[model samples]
Structure formats: C-alpha cells, structure tokens
Target: MKQLNKILLFTVLLGTIYACSTKKDTVISRNYHALTSHFNILFNGEEAFKKGIEGINQGYKDDWFQQLPIEPIVFDDRKIVAPTFKNNSLGAGFGSKKEKTTTTQPAGPFEKAEEKAVKAIQKHGMNINGLERNRKIDDAYLLLGKARYYSQRFVPAVEAFNYVIANYPNANLIAETKIWRAKANIRMDNEEFAIETMKLLLVVTDTLEADLPNDIKEQANTALAMAYVKSDSLQKAKKHLILATRTQENKAQAARNMFVLGQMYANENKKDSAAAVFNKLANFKKAPYKYKIHANIELAKNVVNDSISSSVLSRLEKLIKDRDNRPYLDQLYYQVASLHEKNDSIALAVDYYNRSLRAKNGGDKQKSFTYENLGNLYFKNSEYQFASSYYDSVLNVSTDSLALRIRRVKRKYKNLASLINFENVVATNDSIIRIASLPKNEQESYFKNYIENLKKQDEEAAQLRLNQIAFGANSSSLQTNSKGEWYFYNSQVVSFGKTEFQKIWGKRKLEDNWRWSANASINTRNTDSVNVSKINTRYDLASYLETIPTDKQKIDTLKIDRNQALYELGLIYKEQFKNENLAIRRLERVLSLNPKAELVLPINWHLYQIYNKNGNLEKSNTHKNVILSEYPNTVFAQIIKNPENKIENKEVVNEVEKTYKKLYYLYKKGEFKNVLVNVNDVLPTINNSKLKPKFELLKAYAIGKYLDKETYQRALEFVAINYGSTEEGKKAKEILKQLTKE
Candidate 1:
C-alpha cells in the first residue's frame, strides 16, 4: 500500500508541471500566467506606482503667486537627465566634507514599480504565434509606461506606451494608454503632435460602436487641456478644462480644473464668468481642503466691488478666525491685505502684510511679494532708508534672480544703493560740522550721554549671555570637576569666560601686557602698580571730540563733500526717479552751500529741465539763462540753443552707457536669452560707439549660458579678433584660452 501511494504522488506532480508549460496555447497555461501576473506581480507594481504619485504630490509646492500649471509635477529644466538608482557612496565629490560621511540613496518607488513591471512581462508573459495569450500583459506594459512617465524619462515612456498601442491594439486599456502617450509627447516639447493625437483619440472614441466611459472621456479632455496650456493656447485650454470639470470623475482633479478655468477668465477680465466658476468650486464638498479654501479667496477677489466689499471682507475674516483654517492663514491674510490696498487703506494693508509674514509656515514666494509691497510703499513715500532695507529683505528671500519680478527688485535695489551712499556722506559731514560749531562743554555732554547708552546696551547683552550660560550649566552632560580645572575643561564654561573677556578688554593681540593700549608707543612705562589709568579709547569722550573738524581747511573740505553729495542726489532724483519736487529741493540746497564752478553749470541745467517739465516757466528761465550766458560754449547751452537737436552728443554717450548697464544686469541675473536678443539688436545700431567691444563680450558670455559650448567658443573668437585692443577683448582672449585647455 505504501509503494502504491508514493508512485501515485510522483505521477500527479509530473502532470501538474506539464499542464502549466508557457510554450503551450492550452487554457490551463494561459490562465496560470494571467493569474500570476494579475494577482501577484501587477498588484505590487500598481501599489508602488500609487506611492510614487503620492510622493510627487507631497514634495511639489504650488506657486500661488503665478498661474498654476495643469499638472502639479514640473521637471527642472536644469536636471532633465534620467534619474540614477545607484548609491552615492562617493558623496558630492572626492576630498569634500560630504565624502567623510557615506550616504546611500535607495531606489525610488517609480524605479521599483518599473522593475516589477519588467519582471511581470519577462517571467509570466505568454507569447505564441506572435499573439499575446496572457491578458494581463497589456496592463503590465501600461504600468511600465506610467513608471517611466513619472520618472521624467519621456522618450522611454513614449516607447512603452507605443508598444502596448501597437501590439495590444484591442486591449481594454488601449484608450488610456494612448492618452498617456500624448502626455509624454507634450512633456517632450512635441505639443503639436500631442494636440493632434488627443483630438483624434476623442473623435475615434465618440464614433465607436460601444459607449465610452465618462472617466476615459475626462482623461482625454484633461490631456488636451494640458497640451493647449503647453502651447499657450488658453482659449482652447478653457474649453477642455470646462469639459473636464463637468465630467467630475476625479473630484480633486475636477476642482483643480474649475479653479484654473476661473483664473483664465479672470486674466481675460471676464469677472462674471470667473466668479461663477470659483463660487461653484468654493462650495465643492469633495475637493481637497486647500483647493476649496483658495477657491473662496479667488471668488472674493473677482466679485468684490464698492457694494460688496464689506461682505467679501467679512467672509475672509471669518475664514481667518476659523481654527480649521489655521494652515491657510498666510494666504488668507495676504488676500485681505490686497483688498485693503485696493481700497486705498495702505496702513491697514501694511498691517495685514506683516500679519501674513508672522504665520507659522509661509511660502518663500509669498514672503517675497509682501516684502516687495512694503518696499514699494516706502519708495512712494520717499522713505529711502526703509525702502532700501525692505528691498534687501526681498532679495535675500527671493533666490531666483532670473525671475522677472526678482530682476525688477534687483535693479531698484542697485539704484537705491547709490542714493543711500550719497545720503550717508551728507549726513556724516553735516553731523561733524554741527558738533564742531557747538561749545566745548556741549560736545563733552553729548559724548557722555552716547557712551552711557552704549554701555547700557552692552551690559544688557552680557546679562542675557550669563542667563544662557546658567541654563546650559544645569543641562550639561559633563560632570563637574574642581574649580582649578572646571573653567578650562568645560566647553560651555570656557566659552562664557572668553565672551566676558572680550566684552571688557575688547579684541587684543596675544602679547606681553596686551591690556595696555599704549604698549607699542610707550614701552618703558609698563609697570602694573604705576597708577595706570586704562581708558578704553573706544568709549572715551575725548576720542569723539578730537575727531570733529575744527580747522578751517578741514571744515571747508567737509562742506565741499556735503555740497557734492547734494548735487548728485539732485541729479539722481531728477533723471532716474523723476521726483521733481525732491530734485528742486536738493539742487537748491547745493547752491546755498556755494558749490564749485564745474558743478554750477550741471546743477543749473538739471534745475532748468526739472522746472521746465513742471510748467514753471519763470523758474525754468532763471536757471536756463545761467547755462546760456555764463557757459555759452558748453554742450548744455548748445542743446538749449537748438531744441531740434535734442539728441545731443552727451545723450548718445548716456544712451550707450544705460543700455550696457541694463544688459550687464540681465547677464548677472542669468537672463541669457534676453541678453542675447537685446545684444544682437543693439550691436547693429551701436557699431561706432566706444562701448561696442563691451557689448560683443557680453554677447559671448550670454551665448555660453544659452547655447552650446562650440557656439560660445565661436562668439569669443569673434570678440578676440575684432576688438583685441579693448579691455573686454583682452578678457575674451583669456576665456578662449581656458576653453581651449578644457
């Protein structure tokens, strides 16, 4: 009986192995492969794909300040290469600090999913007589294409999708596969082909014998919308977005489409249409919390008017006060500030902008806008110090200097820097003159009070440091030792001692008797018990009084500097800023201070231009006569004599300098495309200008950034050969040598 049972088990095992052979086209073989791919391999692949999508959604931050793209994931233009799955044990580079610590970057979820999809196809796929018998193999190909798409490898993704469409034409997922292929084409910058393919797919689906599912139709519409957006065809994009929203298959996606549609309408100034769309989206219950909140904000902005302003304000305020909307407070506060600004309540708007910045978590782009708004307010009010500080903050937070908004801020900051320097020089000179004119007693009293305030601030800072040291002492992990060793051995205690020493003795050189300030000059009188009176010269009153200009020649020099600063300030305000009132004030002050002979003519010319622009003919003629009669042979007089020759020789020089300055700034900001375009246009016009060599060199640098290395080399050679005598040409020659070595 035992022998018979063993033989029966051996026969059953052999039969099972033969029945499941993949080379055969039997029903058992096909079902076995399909079940293995579907129930096991494909299931795991789809889960990893879902996780990858979630990762992308979590990592990407939407820039609410600009028009949002249809797809949330954006491939970095500078990082378009295929992602590597290998571990970076070498770190950033050899001998770098990062190389000291080994880091391993695991394979991303998309890569794992791709690996699983490949496994499913290679191990379980059944191909007989050039026909795919495994029904689940098409799904595996679709999964492979999706994995590549999310990895930003568009060419590979397109090929995978094409394989399924070409070989598995009658697959159940054929329509979705085609849609993914169209999306990949759009990503590859082939928007025209994507648009045509999407349109054809829609037409074919509509004419099919079977009714197309609404979800499939929704995807097609979404793909077409993304294609149109890529091509900058907003009108066509609006139609597809509207269709996508109406389908409502994916609630979150539909909500996004509706909001984008409203933004498009708002951009085109169709407020009623925009308000309708936003109002519906704002009330969408199934949408994500962020989308719903932002939708409400958009609705309030579009529909707010004199009659409904109060209502809009009430709604925004209500949202802000809600505890559930805490995470969205930054955006809510910013919208409220914009509303107040539109109503001309600038003070209230400023308060709300500050409140927005105080939110626990605010986006960098949002903070930049707030800082820029405050800077503009101060600039309009002629508060140059405040404006300059706020503009500096904007630049610090906004790292993308290539953005148009950042470029504008950078230019304003550069111009403001010159004005600030002039203002500082004038202020310093005026302060010195005023102190010198005062009585000796008054000067002594003023220095004493300043010293007292400085000492008080220092004492408060020292006390704060002591409090921090006490806290550290209680929490320190090190065991305490005897006093002889404790002060030097404990790091925190030693740090505190160094701070105290520096505070009292200031920074001193390591030498014998370093405490004595007069050691180098008076080396013989160095006894410690010789009644040494150590007066810290930094805080001494005599040090302040001795620096004041008391000599007539020195006083005159201060006045001259003050007058020069006022003259330049007048010109900057008049020519660059167009502040006629400020210009007249500053220029007139220069005259009162008795400016030099060379400054007299230029100041008068600027005063004449400003007053004449303001229609004050009486004031204009008074200064104009000074230039015309006193400096008759000057270019200013020549220009006034013949108004038709408005483009004076100096004007040509100024134009070239100004154009070069703008191009240089654009190059610094990495706007190479615009720099190249403007350089090409201006080079043809300024063929005779002395600054022509500078423009040629700038064009070469732009080519290096915006085009290929070979093109850059050719451009540099042109500059080196044509204008070799100029400084720019010499610099270009050096760069060409470096390129050759590379």
Candidate 2:
C-alpha cells in the first residue's frame, strides 16, 4: 500500500511538470518562465554585465591633455560576434563552422554577458501567440543592447534598444533604454538626431508628470549633455551637466561631467563660472580621487594672478609633498614650472621643468608637453643646443594629432641644428689652430700636462671598476659602501696597495689588457738577457705631437672652413633666429678671420642690418659703407640702395636643387668623378643659396670615394663646418667620426 502511494505521487508530479508548457498561456507556464528568466538567467546576466563594466572602468584611461569624452569605453576590433538565436534553421544543438569557431574562442566580459542574455531570451522567452509572457524578456533585451553598446557595435545596439521599446512600451526601464539609445546615437556621430531624441525623452519623462525616476532623469540629462558637447554646443552642455550632477546616481560620472563643464567655462574665459564648478567638484566627498585632484588643479589655475600666485604655488607644493599624490607629480611639477615661467622666475621654471621630466609614472603626453615648454623656454633664452635636445624629446613622445605645433617645432629645430653645427666647428677649429701655432717646447709642455690629466682620469676610472668588482664579490662590502665607507677608508691598506702596485708595474698605464705580460714586452724566453724598462708610446710627448697639423695648407683650409661657418651662423642668427647680439658677435668674428672676398660683403650686409635694427646707426653705417664700396654691383648693395628691392633668386634656388638631385643620382650610380665635377661647378654659381649645403655634401661624398683619405676628410670637414645644421652637413659629420675611428 505504501509503494502504491509513492507511485501515484511520482505520476502526479510528472503530470504537473508536463502541464507547464511554454506554448500554453496558463498562469503556471507564465510564472514558471518569468521566475526562471528573472531569478536564474537574468540574474547571472546582470552580474556579468556589472563585471564587464568594472573591467572597463579599471582599464580606461582618460586623455587629460584634450577635452575628455563622455563615455569611458575604448573599443577595438578584437571581438567576433556569434550567431544569434533567431537563426533556428540549423538544429537546436547544431551550428555552422563559423558559429562553432566563435564558440571555441574565449569571450571577453561583454561578450559573455551578451551570451547569457541571448540564452535567457532563447530558452525562457514565452512567446505565446507573438506576445512575450515572460516579464524579464524586456530586461534581457536591455542587457543585450548595453553589451553591444560597450562593444562599439552601435547599430546593432540601437536595434536591440528599439526592440525593448517597441515590444514593451510600458516597461519600467523604458526611460533608461531611451537614454542608452541616445548615447549610442552620439557615439555614432549623429549628434543632431541624438539631441532631438534626448530632448523628447526629457519631455516625455518630465518630473512634473511624475513618470521619471531620479536615476532615469539623471541618465537622460547626462546623455543630452554629451550630445551637446559632441555638437560643439558647450553652453547648452553646461546646463544639462549641471542638472545631471544634482540627481546623479553615478558619483564618478557626475564628477567628470562637472570637471568637463568647468574646462569649457575656462576655455571661454569665464573664470568665475569655471571656478565655481571646480570648487564644488574639489570639495565633493564621494567623487573619484583623480577627479577631485584635477578639480583642485583647475581651481588653482582659475585663480592664478599676481596677488594669489604665492598662495596657488603653496597649494600645488603641498600636493607635491603629499605621498598620496605621488602618481600626479609630473603634472603638479609642470604646473609649478608654468607659474614660475609666467612670473618671469626663469631659473625656478627651468628647475621645475627638469623635475617634471624626472617624475615617476608620468604619461607620455604630459612628458611631451613638458619637454616642449622647456624647449620653448630655452629657445627664448637663446640656448639653442639645450632647446634642440628638448624639442627632439618632444617629437619622440608627442602624438601625431598636433600637426601644426609639430611643424613649427621642426622648423625651429632645423634652424637650431645649423647653429649647433657651426658652434661645434668654431670650438674645434679654434682649439686646433691655437695648439698648432705654439712653439715646440710649449707644445711639448702642453701635451705632457694633457697626458698627466689623461693618466689621472684613467686611473680613477680603473679604480672605480675595481671597487665595483670588490663590492659585488662581497655583500658586506656593498652594504658598507652604501653607508659611506669608501674603498680607501683604511689608509694603511690603501698605502700598501699603492706601493705594491708601483713596485710591480712601474707606473704602468691603466687600460684594456693592462695585466697581460705581452703588453709589458718582457721576453719570457730570456728574461735576464732583455731590459725590463721600456716607455709606453701613448704616454710619450712625441706620440701626441705627431697628431697635430704641421702643414700650412691644411691649417689654412681649416681657417677657411671655420670662417665660412661663422658667416653662415651670423646670417642664421640675424635672419632666422632674430638675435642681434649673436649675429653681431658671429659676423664680427668672421671679419676678424679675414674672410674670403665672396663672404666679406654678405657678412657686412648682415651686420649692417643687425646694427640698424638695434638703433646703432654709427656701427650700421660702417658696414653699410663697406658693402657699398667693396661690392657695389652685388645683390646686397642693390638691396641696400633700395629697401624695396627684393632678392628674388627663386629660379636660381630651384636650379640648384635640381643640380643636387642629378649629382646625387650620379653619386648613387658610382659616377664619383662626374658628381664631383658637377657639384664644384654648381656650388660656385649658387654660393649664397640655401641649397649650397646639398651640393657641398655631395662633393664630400664623391671626394671620399675618388680621392685619398686626407682629401676626403678635408672635403667632409668643409661641409660639416659650412652647413653644420643641415641634413647633408650632419651626415658629413657622422662620416667624419667613422673615418677618424678607422
């Protein structure tokens, strides 16, 4: 009787399960599907969606250098979409090759959430007579839309959102879905449509009607603000952004919205409005740490004036000293540098710029901007070499979007390159000429002193290496060294080592392979028969003297090259750089060198212009009279005679470039002699042309291939000095260095 009762109970349970059919519109079927969809499938789907959003928040980095975007999503073409549920032509368990491939591949959080949503819709959706009885079906569609939106598939995401709105118009989350739809529209760059739709959504869900929840109202306002921002309507954006912040469910987004709104006001020069916005954001307790920090920075920027400069600087300095603000040290340092620069405290500005560069964990864009500022500061101070280095660093890290700024920097760097090259030439040639002119005794004394210095440097370097080795071998020694215990701290041990070293080596040179017996040249076969005492040639005065130029012709050539560099540098300073003092200095040195007839008139004309610009008419007339008297028929004289008369050498410049290209082609084809002949002929005709550098460098390359090493070096040296800042000139300098090594 008990076994019969158990069988009857099992039969009734099976019947009850079978009776809950999805095709039937009974209360049992509807409740079963709704509960399963909501509690099981939709619950997991929502959790996965939240996880995906968390991942995105963790990874997304806002570019603070530019206007921040509304959304934090940055999409890539990495995800492959899987087949949808509606395509049921294939069996429920079967799929095509493409679908199978998609299934086998690992999916990201968004894709996993999307998969769960699709599963809920396909399995639990109770479409009885074309009406979804499962209440959670609308939620599943909303989830699907959100996943697609974040995945950057805006069109498909819109389709999913439209389905939710069309199928379930009275759904509790309809207002939220519309806001998502508008956001997707903004992302697609249809800001006009997004703006209109968002406005309509606001009207439909008006607070006066009591239809919209506070969170939904905030989402709608945020969407509308983003739409306006995208359309370049910052004023309209500010109103909505303000409204959005008042009822914000997401404190982080609200903080960012406020910050962007403040930036817009600052951009428009509405400092008071911007200050009010930033002040509030800075004091917001629930705001993200980054937004709050930047808020304080923006607030300080707004109040930067003569009276408040001290206070502002103190505030930034306090932030810098705080350990919690370590990650933002680069930006803080940059701001301090900018403030010092504005106040004309140039030395402090330079110090702060360097500090910014050395700060840890800085963004590349921040570093680029800092480098550019430092470069500009040095450029203004006439420190071309330092400026060139900083500008080069900026180019290395700066984004390609800054096309105009990059172009301007390149132009300045090119001009500075020339100055650097000529400066190097003057220093090098001056040293050589001065040393070559000294008497033999004085020259010998100079080399002996130089050798002594060289010995000291080498010995110090060798000792440093030895100390490093000793420290590495003994851990205790490293610890002691770190504590300021020098390797020579024990005077007795140091004296013993020094005495022992001198006894065995007899003041041997510290160099590579120094300990080898072969270097000592002692005969191991007959040690007693050979003399142990021998001089190292590197330490001998004659060895150093032999390297100096004794030939008058070579020395003369160097003087000519140095003079030409001075002439070019003068023109660059006066014309390109507009530095009157440097121009005067360089041109005066050229005249003192007794420059060639060809260079004399040009150098004088440049000095005349510089002095004239400086209101030193007496000095200006001196050069003006010289140019008119010495080269009356020249272009310089013509220009001086009539200020309106321009030197239109466009055709000549074009012809010079064409000639250089032909010569370069011949050079590449191994026609070295032809290249040399053409370059020499063309160079004389275009002596004052900017394209002269190209022909000169080509001539050097041809000489390198066809002439002796000494002549090749002389040709290269000429190019290096005459066109130091040019691309061709830099190549010549590089080649010269390699030749010296060889």
Candidate 3:
C-alpha cells in the first residue's frame, strides 16, 4: 500500500506541472502564466524601476542659476552603449545595491530593472495560436522604457518607448509612454519633434481633462515648457511654466518653475512684475529652502532706491540672524553687500563682502563674485596691488563658462602687475644706489651690521639643530631597553651606527674598497665641496662687500633702468590708475634724476595735466611753458595749444583707420608677408596713436599665418603683454590659450 501511494503522489505532481505549461492554449495555463508574471516577476520589476528613479533623483544636483530640466536625467555624451538584454534574473538586484564593490560587474538599479523586465518577458510571456495572452506584458515594457531612459541610453530608450506606443496603444500607460518618448526626443536634441509631440499630447489631455490624472497634466505642461526653453522662447515658456506650477504635484519643480518665470520677467526688464512673482515665491510655505532664499535675494535686487522701505532692511537683518539659514549665509551676505553698494555705503558694502568670503560653505560662483566686487572696488580707489590680489582670487575660483568676464579681469590684472613690477624695481634700485653713494667707512659699517645679523641667525639655527638631535636621541632611548646595546635589533643604535659610519667614511657605497677614504671621497666631493665654499663666502665680510655693484658703467646703466621704470610707473598711475598724487610723486622723481630729452616732454605734459586737474594753475603753467618752448614740434605742444580741437584728432584717427582697413584687406587676401611689412612700417609712426594696437594685432596675425609656431607664439605673447587692455590684445590671449591647449 505504501509503494502504491508513492507512485500515485509522483504521478499527480507530474500532471500538475504539465498543466501549468505556458505553451498550452487552455484556461488554466493562460491564467497561471498571467498571474505569475503580474504578481511575481512584474511586481519585482516595477519596484526595481522605482528604486532606480529614486537613485537618479538623489544623485542629480540642480544648478539653480540655470533653468531646470523637467526630468533629472544626467546624460553623458561619451557613454553611448547599445542595450543588451540578459536572460538570467539573478542580476535583477543590480539596481537595488547602493554600494558597488567591483568594476567588472554590471551595476545600478536601472540595469537591474531592465534585467528583471527582460526575465519577465522571456520566462512567463504566453503567446499561443497566433494570439498573445499575457496581461502584464505592457507594464513590463513600460518599466523597460523607463529603466533605459534613466540609464542615459536614449536611443535604446526611444526604441522601448516606441514599442509600447505602437503595440500597446490602448494600455493605461500609453499617455505616460508618450510623455517619456517626448522627453527622450529632447535629450537626443530633437527639440522640434518634442515640441510637436508634446503639443499633441496636450490637446489630447485637454479633451480628456476630466478623466486624465493631475500628475499627467503637470508632466505634459512641464515637458512643453522645457521644450520652449530649449528653443529660447522664454515668453512661451513662462506661460507653460505657470500652468505646470499651478498643479503643485512636485513642489521642488514647481518652485523651480516659478523662480525661472521670475527670472524671465527680470530679463525682459519688467521690474514690477518680477518683484511680484519673487515675492509670491518668498511667501510660499512649501517651497524648498534654496528657492525661497534665492527668491528673497531676487526681491532685494529688484528693490528701487526711491521705494525701499525700512521693512526691507529689517527683513534681511532678521534672515541673517536665523540659525536655520546658516548653510545659505554666503548668498545672503553677498546680497546684503550688493544692497549696501547700491545705497553708496561703501564701507558697509566692503564689510559684507568680506563676510561672504569668510562663510564656510560658499559656492565657487558666489566666492568669485565677491572677489570680483572687491577687486573692482579697490581698483576704483587706485589701490592696484590690493585690486590685483582680489582679482587673483577671482580667477582661482571662477569657472570656465565665465570666459568673457575672465578675459576682462585678466587684462586689468596684467596692467596692474606691470605697474606694480615697475614701481618695485624703481624703489629697490633707488635704495641700492643711495647706499652705494655712501662713503667707504659707512659702507663697511653697514656690511658689518648685516654680517652680524647673519651670524646670529646661523648660531640660532645651529642651536635648534642640536636641540632636535638631543630630542631624537632621548626618544630613541625611551623606545628601547637593554636590547638597545645590539645595533641590529635596536633601531636607535642602528641609526647611530650608520650616522657615525657616514661621518667617518662619507657615504661609502657597498663596494670592494669599503674602508678606503678615497673610495668614499667620490660620493661626497661634488655636494660637500659646493656647500663648504658657499658657507665660507657667506661668513667672510670682505667677500660680502665685494658682491656689491661697484662698476661705474654698470651703476650708470642701473640708474638709467631705474629712471625709465619710474617714468613708466608715473605715466601708468596717471592714465591707467587715475591717481594724480602718485603720478606727481613718481614724475617729480624722474625730473630730479635728469630724465632723457625724449622722456622730459611726456613727463612735463603729464605733470601739467595732473596739476591742472588739481587746480594748481601756477604749476600747470610752468610745465606747459617748458613743453611749448623746449618741444614745440611734439604732439604735447600741439595738445597744449588747442585742448578742444576735436576735429584734428578725429582726422588723425580717420587716417589711421584707413591704413588699418587697407592692411586688413590685404590680410584677408592672403598677402601675409606684405601685411607684416606694412603693419610694421605704420606702427612706429603711430606710437602714441589709438590705432597702434590694431596695427600690432594685424602684425601678430600675419606672423601667425607666415612664420613658425614659436615665432607666432612670441608675437601673440608680445601683444598680450604690451597692449593687453585693447580688444585685439584680448583676442591674442584667447588664441594663445587655444594653441597651448592643443
């Protein structure tokens, strides 16, 4: 009886397994496969798809300065790979694993979702007698499309979306599939097609407005707005963004849309409208903290001086004191600084700018703006060194997208660098020359004092070394016991042995002559000999005195260089820095040095301008008469004769322009060598004219076209260094950057 029962149980199990086969065209087989696919495989697939979406959203960082995309898909243009379907379902957990441990294995929740989706189709799909019976196949396809979309495989994602749209037209996910299709189109740079499809989706949804879900309506509207934004139709985008925000399904996106709408109004110069929109966002209770904070900043920016109330300042102060807003202090401080600047409270503005820089978590963009603002402020005050320092900070923090602004800052900083360099040279040389003019006894006394200071430093350094060695020896002793007597077992003893050996043998390498002094001598000869020679020279007072410049011709040449640098610095302070007092001091020094005849006219003219601007009529007349009597044929004399002769200067500019036009035409005609010769011939004649930069730039271009790369680089470098403030010079710098990058 037991044997019979076992046989019967085995037979019943076999029959049940046969009845569940998906190939059978029966009620039981179809329902069984459908239930298994929907409740088991497809259920897990949908969950994986949702997790993938969460991962994407959590990883994406929105740049609030730019308009936000409807979806948070981060696309990588270099990662275009064809989608391959896996047969095994074991890899379905790929999307759920947050931490990836291996590079060789496939990862990401989206890839897992795709694997589960493929498994469902392959293992449980039932198609019998030319008819498909699986009910959850459409859901599987929907999941597949979304997984591909999030994975940044747009072409494959489109194929999946198209499959669902073509094969499952009456499915519940058809509308969503269409929306996904349009999004994929936009990512593929098919904005026109996306726009058309979204418009059609909108019309269909409008007809079924009562039946369609609110989230669907919101998605459609937001997709249309993104499409319009891509096409640069901000007005049209604003309308759709308004509709999308009204749905309130996605609070973060709604806040972003409202902010972009306000920005659009600001861009169009609708100050009142922009203020109203930003104020509405600021009052929104559920908006993200970032959006609300930035809205308040926009409101502050739009505040007109005539209408600014006490409440405005009070509101900003209250925000600054709020502990919860600490993470956003960088932007808040910058906004406050801008407000003070607008009110002409320069001291307060500078304080706030410094506060912004001191904030712990400031974004690079905000820090760059703060640095640039400080640079501009100091530059306007004629503090070129301080301004250059601030501008350097700006460049260090600025991003590559700020190319034009970076160019302008670099040009200004380069000019300031030149002025600073020449000023330092003049000051240093003047001090040296003054010391050199002293009597021999005084010079000896100065050298003696300097040598004494050096001796003191050497003594202090020797004492420090002795203290460090003592500390190291004590530490080594503490780290050992009686075992320290063994050189190989004790680290300190081994170290001491090595050092003593080196002191006697002088770094003898392991070789046949292990103890011969001459064998070790080769190792120490080069470095030790030089160091000993330098130490001997440094300690000898006579050697130190001999190092001072004493040749008459060399001293005279240095004096000339000093006077030239001083004269250039004076002109820079007057014209570039607009600091008349500093210019007067430098130019007066040049006059005292007995500057050359060529420099006297310009220096006197500059002094005249400076004195005239300061209302010193007597001093201005003195310089003006000198220029007129001594250099009557120069441009300075002509300028003094008729200060208001605009027509004459205009005519001179017109002639230069004509020359530039002719040379530029020749350049365009491929006469590269001729262009170079003509530009050089015309440059010296227009040394002080405004057209010199244009002529020099033409020459640079000609050199680049006809000469070797090294020569071209040198020519561009010359323009960048000497004529950096001009537009042509900026172009030269940009080209040089490209060449270097290549």
The Cα error of candidate 3 at residue 314, in Å, is 5.1
Candidate rank order under TM-score: 2, 1, 3
**Which of candidates 1 and 2 is the stronger one according to lDDT?**
1
lDDT of 1 by residue, 459-577 (tens): 68876776666556656653263243334556667677578857775666678966454532322356664554456886777788888777999999999999978987886787578
Query: Mind giving the per-residue lDDT tens digits that candidate 2 earns over 1-742?
Result: 9999999999989867864566777777788888888888888888888998898888888877666776676655455334354454212222332353345432777877777777777777777766778888889889988988887777778878888888788888888888889988887778898888878878855844557777887888889998888888888898998899897688888888888888888988888888789889988999999998887777767874676667778888999999999999989998888888889999999899889989999888888889999999888889889999998988888777457887788777777887899888988999999999999999999998997887677667657655654455345433443434564654444554576555444554567867433366443557467566565665667778998999999999989989978877886787668788888888898899799865675577667877888899999999999978986765567668987533444456567777778878889999999988877566545656877777777787888887999878767766664555567867987897798899
How do the predictions measure up, each by TM-score? Answer: 0.73, 0.74, 0.68
Q: Which candidate leads in lDDT?
A: 1
Worst 10 residues of 2 by lDDT: 89-98
Score residue 474 of candidate 2 by CA lDDT: 46
Instruction: Mark the regions of model 3 whose C-alpha exceeds 4 Å error after superposition.
Output: 1-35, 64-70, 78-106, 126-135, 208-211, 266-279, 293-327, 361-365, 399-402, 430-560, 577-585, 608-620, 633-742
RMSD of each: 13.6, 9.3, 11.1
Candidate ordering by lDDT (highest first): 1, 2, 3
Candidate 1 scores a C-alpha RMSD against the true structure in Å of 13.6
lDDT of each: 0.81, 0.78, 0.76
- lDDT per residue for candidate 3 within 1-742, as digits (tens), equals 9999999999988877976776776777677777888888888878878887777777888675555565556688778665564443223222222333344433877878877776676666665664456777667777887887888887777877886677667778788888888887887778789889888777865676436677887788888888888888778888898888887787877888888888888878787888888888999899988889888878877775545634556677789999988887888888888888878889999999999999988899889889999999898887878999999998888886457888898888888888888878887888778778888889889988986788578656655554555456556653554354333555564466566545433565688944433344442467546522122445456776776688888778879889988877786777677788888999998898887664676678778988998999999999999989987865567668977422233338788889899999999999999999988677656766887888887898999997998778767866764555467767987898799898
How far is 625's C-alpha from truth in model 1 (Å)? 6.7
Q: Would you list the clashing residue pairs of candidate 2? A: 417-725, 418-725
